[model samples]
Target: MKAVMVSAFGGPEVLAVVDLPDPHPAAGQVSITTEAIGVGGLDSLIRSGALANHGAAPGRILGSEVAGTVTEVGEGVDTAWAGRRVWALTGESGGYTEQAVVSAETLVPLPADLSAVDAVTLGSSAMVAHFALRHAHFARGESVLVRGAAGGIGVIAVQLAARAGAGAVAVTTSSAERGARLRKLGATHVLDRAGRGAQDAPAGYDVILDIVAGADLPSFFARLEPNGRMVAVGVMAGTPPADFGMEMVAAFRKSMSFATFSADTVPALEQRAATAELFTAASRGELVAVVHEELPLEQAVVAHQKMEAGEVFGRIVLTPSRR
Candidate 1:
């Protein structure tokens, strides 16, 4: 099997496609022949040495989400899943290759209307969005603010909230053009990051799905309703500031809850079920993965470059160029 492997941490240049042994499933596991690979910010972090100590890199396969067909089954696995289309979030890294193994429990069947490309594109982002929104216990007629609303997770979050009966969904993006596009994707309010208008998001939101961190925190925390909740999914803008104490205290006093989500930790059953719901929504034209581009797996370096440069407006998926 050919895969993107990283032996050292540095940059996108570190990811090299090379032949590697195919992974065989252990007991209770299944082997999937990769069809589409999801490229994300975490992949970049792992390649750049940021996640080196996190136990995911160095002489390891580099991918977290995959959509593929079952080619083989291990002991204790149900034979029914063989040849079925599925996607999964692997706890350990190995989604970039031609074939990868995962516990049968992690597999989620792809819907008839959804393609392998779409499944991989949404990957864990949609799952995380669902968990965050559901965990926040949002009610009908409430409003929420979302940062990075044009990105993979934000787009899904906006649609989910809208369908769940939000009074309004306010979203912000660094690119004015992308912000404009988000409006058509169900965003009720689109703020331009170029003009510092994100500062006003606190005024109208009862909850916030934060994908970016740093100075944006102060502005975002101030926008939440008295009992509003904030789910922190990423720190695209960098880490929090030194004086982040105010927001922490505000959250404590107002009974606000701050949380983070990782699909890697999601239960296999829940991942499959949530992914099925998301795919159903996509099939009905309710939720769609805003795919900005598709590149060959060998060009993963270029994909990471685009993501890190903030040039991509939505999810980018990689496909194996060879069988």
Candidate 2:
């Protein structure tokens, strides 16, 4: 099997394709012949040593989610899954290879109408968006502001919020072109990456889904309406200052709230169920899987480069079978 590994944690250049022995499934596990792999900002963070303290290290296979067909099942596993197509969360790694092994329990049977590319693109990201909105206690007709709304999670978040009947779905994106695309996905308003157009909201946002957390974090916090909730899901711009939360404390009179969310914290059963729902919605065209482009698996380095450069509009899927 050919796998891309972090030769050394530094830049995209550090990712190298190397030949490795095929991996097999253990008891209660299954092996997949990967068709598509989802590349995410977290993968870049792990590869660049930005998350070193979080257990990232050299020689790691850096991928989290993939979609493919199951070719083998381990002991005590159902034989029916052997030839089934599924989307899987590979935990924290092992997805950047032609074949991946994961616990059978983590598999979400792909909808018959969903392609591998769409499966991987919407799998984890859609679930994250779904849970984040729920965590924010989002209510129908409540205004939503999706910061950094051009990535996989952000794009899906916009649609989900709109579909749930948000009065307004505002997004912070890099350009008019990207924002225009987001509008088509249900964004009622578009703001620049700096959140320039947020001031137009009459009472500020009722819920803010922030994917970029950094120096600008405080500014967005100020845009929250009284009693509003802000959920930070990704630190793509980098982590905010340690005391960034002091803003929330100082604004205590407004009764606003701030929180951080990760899909990891969601129970496995719930995550699988949510993923299934998302896949079904997408299959029925109730949702859209925004794929910026698909590259061969060996181009993992290029995928990381594009993501870090902020040149991608949506998910960049890697087709392992392309090679």
Candidate 3:
């Protein structure tokens, strides 16, 4: 087997692709011959030492999501899973490899027609967006805002919000071209992320799906409509200001609510259910999983470079060499 390892915590240059022994599942787990691997921002964070608290050490196998065919099952697991097409969270290892062993609870059977590439790409991003929106308790005819709407989760959030019957769908992005593209994907307004574009939001928004965090977080919080909810699922803009706690005080009179979501701690059954729904939606052509590029697994270092530079508009997937 071959896997990409983080030789050290620094930059994409630290990524090393090397041979490793094939992995087998343990009790309550399954082994997958991976077909598609998801390259995410978190991978870049881990490589750059930005997420040191995540406990990643040198020589770590780096990937969190994968799509593949189940080739084996472990103790107390159903053999029926073998030969099935499935997608899973590799937890902390094996995702960047030719094979991955994941907990049975993390595996979700794919629709017969969904390719492994699409399944992993859409399933991972949509899982987070779905959970965040569900927690916000979004309602029909309300104005919805998706901050950082060009990335994977942000793109999916825009489409899901529109489908949920939002009267207006607004998003913040880095460029006009990206904004134009997002508008075609159901965003009614695309604000220039680095400017005061958000100040133009009319009467504020009802449900805010925030993928960014920084000194500006408080201003984003202040934009919520009365009784509005803002769900923070990412910190792509870096950590929020030290005074973020103080910023929340400004939202008190508006009755605005704030919450944060960490997919890391989401229960297995819940992750399964959310991913299943995304798979169904994708199979029905109701949800779009925007893929920016597909590269061979060997190019993972380049993939991480693009992600960290914000050069990709959607998900980038890595494919293991065909067996």
Candidate 4:
């Protein structure tokens, strides 16, 4: 099997395509023949030694989101999943190869109407969005704001907020090209992030989903209505510095709270249920994942470069040699 491996960490150039022995599942696991692999920003982070938890080990392949067909079941695994289309979070890594092993527990049946491309893009992004939204404890007909609205998790956050019956939906993006698409995805208002124009955003959004942490935190804190919440998923821009201010204190005094998450913080059952719901929603056309580009497995370097350069508004999928 051919896989993209990061021999060392530094840049996209560190990633190379090499032939490796095909993977076989252990007990309670299954081997999937790659149909599509999701290229995550975190994968780029892992390749660049940015993300703490996903750093490259000497022999590690750099991806965790996979959507493929079950080709073989290991001992103690149910054969019922054989030949079924499935998508999963492969614990840590091993998703970039033509054949990779995943625990049966992580595999979720792909809905009949969902394509491999769509399912792979959802990857961990959809679940993170789900967790953030639920953490906000939002009510129906409440307003919500999403930052980095053109990115993988940002897009999912927009759709999920709309499906949650938000009274008003606002999404912010730096690119002009994504504005129309964001609106189509159910954003009632699209904020132009390029001009530092978030000052024009309507005040009192009940929930703020902050994927781009470069925004004025105090300003976002001020935008929250009394008792509103903000969930910080990613700091794509950069992390904010800790500072003392009355407004920051007052923001908390006004009953606003901020939160973030990791897969380790998500319980297994909750993760399973969220993936199941996402698949169901995709089948119903309520959740739509956008795939902006597809590259062959060997071109993984180019794919990572696109991500690192912030050139892709949606996901980039990888197809193995056999595909």
Candidate 5:
């Protein structure tokens, strides 16, 4: 089998495709013949050594999500899963290969109408957006501001919020073109990356889905209305300063709240349900899975480079040669 691995922790150049012996699933696991692999910011962070302390190291495969067909199932797994089309979570690694082994429980049967590219694009990102909005207690008719809303999860969050009857769906994106695209996807207002247009919402936002958390996090937090809730789902700009929370405390009189959410904490059954719902919505044309582009699996390095450079507007999927 051929796989892309982090030969060293550095830039995108460190990702090298190499040949390896084929892997077979163990007990309770299944092996997938990958059709498409999703690439995201976390993969870049791991490749750059930013997550080394978290067990990301040299020689590690650099992918977490994939969409493909099951070729083999291990002990304790159902034979029915073999030859079934599915999208799966490959934990922290092992997805950047022609064949990936993952626990059977992690597989979500792909909708018949969904393409492999769209499956990988919306697979985990839609789940995160769904749960993150729930964490923020988002309600219909409430205003929502999706920070860093041009990325995969952010794009899904925007549409989901709008579809749920949000009174306002505002987004912070890099350019007018990207913002225009978002507007068509249900964003009511488009702000620059610095959140310039947010001032138009005089009462502030009722819910803020922040995918970018860093020095500018406080600025967005301040935009929340009284009794507003802000859910941090990603730290694309890097972690915020330690004292950033003091601002939230200072605004106690507003009764505002801040929280961080990750799909990892969600129960497997709930996650699976959400995944199925998202896929169904997509297949029904109720949700759009934005894919910026698709590259051959061997070009994994180029995929990371585009993602890290902020050149990608949505998800970038890698298609294995077999696909």
Candidate 6:
């Protein structure tokens, strides 16, 4: 099978297409033939060594999720899964290849109505958005604010917030074009993120989903309404500094709380439950995933570059150049 491997750690230039022996499934696993592989920002982070401290160094393919048809099922697995279309999380072995092995448990059977492209696009993103909002204890009629709302998880956050009956759904994005797209997706207000958050955002948000973390933390903290809650999600901009401090006097008096959500922190069954809900929603056409571009697997370097350049507002799908 051909795979796009991060031959070295540095930049998108390091991603190389290499032919490797096809991977086979072990017990309780299945082999999936590539259809649409999700090209996420975290894959770029691993290729660029930005997450080297967390073991994202080179010499590995860096796909996060895959949507494909099951070609083979290993022992202890149900043969019925074979030939069934599915989408699953691939973890670190990655899914940027013609064939990859995935744990059977991670596979989510795609409804006949859902295309593999759309399933892969929102597979992990919708679940993350759901988990983040749930962690914040989001309530109906609450005002919701989503940072990095043009990106994968953030876009889902915006949609889910609006669909969940948020009194208002505000989003922050890079341009008028992206913001307008977000508005069509359910954002009641779209603010330009290039400006200071405090200056760009409306005050009194009941739920703030912070996908971009940087020097903008304090400003975002200020936008929270009294008793508002903020959930720190993806650190796409950069991780918060150790000394990151907010003006807590107001926060303390208002009973506002800040927290973080990670899929790793949740139980496996709980995570899958969220994923199931997402798949059900997608099948019902209640959740829509945007695919910004599709490229051959060998063009991973181009994909990662586009991600880092902020040229893509949605997920990118990559397929093996060969069968």
Q: Please write out the lDDT profile of model 5 over residues 188-305, one tens digit for every residue.
A: 9989888886456545899999999989999889989999999999888989888887878988999999999988799988999999999999999999999999999999989998
User: For candidate 2, lDDT tens digit of each residue in 1-323?
Assistant: 98899999899999999998888899989999999999988888899899999987898888988899999999999989989999999975579999999888889999899999999999899999999999999999999999989998999999999999999999999899998899899999889888776456545999999999998998898989999999999998898878877867988998999999988799999999999999999999999999999999999989989987889988999998543
Error of 5 at 202 (Å): 4.4
Candidate 6 differs from the real structure by a C-alpha RMSD in angstroms, to one decimal, of 2.0
lDDT per residue as tens, model 6, 161-255: 99999998988888888988998899888787843333444567999999888878767777789889989987888877655644655458878
Per-residue lDDT tens digits of candidate 3, residues 186-290?
998878774256555666888888898766778878888889999998888788888877768755888889999877668889889889988999989998888
Better of 2 and 6 by TM-score: 2
**Residue 256, candidate 3: C-alpha displacement in angstroms:** 1.1
Shift of residue 165 alpha carbon in model 2, Å: 0.3
For candidate 3, the per-residue lDDT at 130 reads 82
On the 0 to 100 scale, the lDDT of residue 157 in model 2 is 98
Model 1 segments more than 4 A misplaced: 198-202, 250-253
Superior candidate under lDDT, 3 versus 6:
3
What are the per-residue Cα lDDT tens digits for candidate 4 across 14-86? 8988888888889989999989998987787677776655445746887887888999999999899999999
lDDT winner, 2 or 4: 2
| TM agreement with the true structure for every prediction | 0.93, 0.97, 0.96, 0.93, 0.98, 0.94
Off by over 4 Å in 5: none
Against the true structure, candidate 1 has what lDDT? Answer: 0.80
lDDT of 5 at 314: 82
Lowest summed lDDT window (length 10), candidate 2: 194-203
Model 2 lDDT, full chain set? 0.91
